[model samples]
Target: MAKEVSCPNCGKPVEWSEQSQWRPFCSERCRLIDLGEWLNESHRIADPTDAPSEDPPPSDDLSTPH
Candidate 1:
């Protein structure tokens, strides 16, 4: 059995381990298009939730200090 997922390029359905030469992509053209979209900032996902916690940086507090 093959797992299914959406094609990142055109939002089409595709299957994992599918009979495709492009594998993750539906086709070679779609793969290239996806790459171009990434380069152009046309596509983006959630922020790095995997980011590590860090100390707060120096900044002026805008509170009324009540």
Candidate 2:
């Protein structure tokens, strides 16, 4: 027997097998919904930690000729 997994979008039970076209998502609607969320920036991956940077700006000597 194949193991079952829940759909990420609608929380529906999905079979983890070759027969399941949408393995993570239950249906096309759910898949599209998830895509829309990503496109709209509703879903984001969190960073491990926030660090401040103190890098200096690049010199503009190359842009100006003597």
Candidate 3:
């Protein structure tokens, strides 16, 4: 039997098998909606470090004059 999973966006039951093109999503619409959320910054992956990313300090080593 194929494993069943709930759609991440719609809570619809989905079959975890080769036929499930969208896999975790119920349909293309649901997938697009989820994509839109990420694109709009409504969804974000939790940073494991739990700290805002910062740019590395500029290197002080001066390059040899070309």
Mind giving the per-residue lDDT tens digits that candidate 2 earns over 15-65? 989888988888889989888988756334443234456667666767666
lDDT of 3 by residue, 1-66 (tens): 999999999999999998989988888899999889886663245544556778776666565443
Give the TM-scores of the predictions, in the order they appear.
0.48, 0.59, 0.60
Error of 2 at 7 (Å): 0.4
lDDT, candidate 1, at 38: 85
Q: Clashes per prediction?
A: 0, 0, 0
Most accurate candidate by TM-score: 3
lDDT preference between candidates 1 and 2, better one: 2
Lowest summed-lDDT stretch of 10 residues in model 1? 42-51
* lDDT winner, 1 or 3: 3
State in Å the error of residue 41, model 3: 0.5
Candidate 3 Cα outliers beyond 4 Å, as residue runs: 42-66
Q: For model 2, state the Cα shift of residue 53 in Å.
A: 24
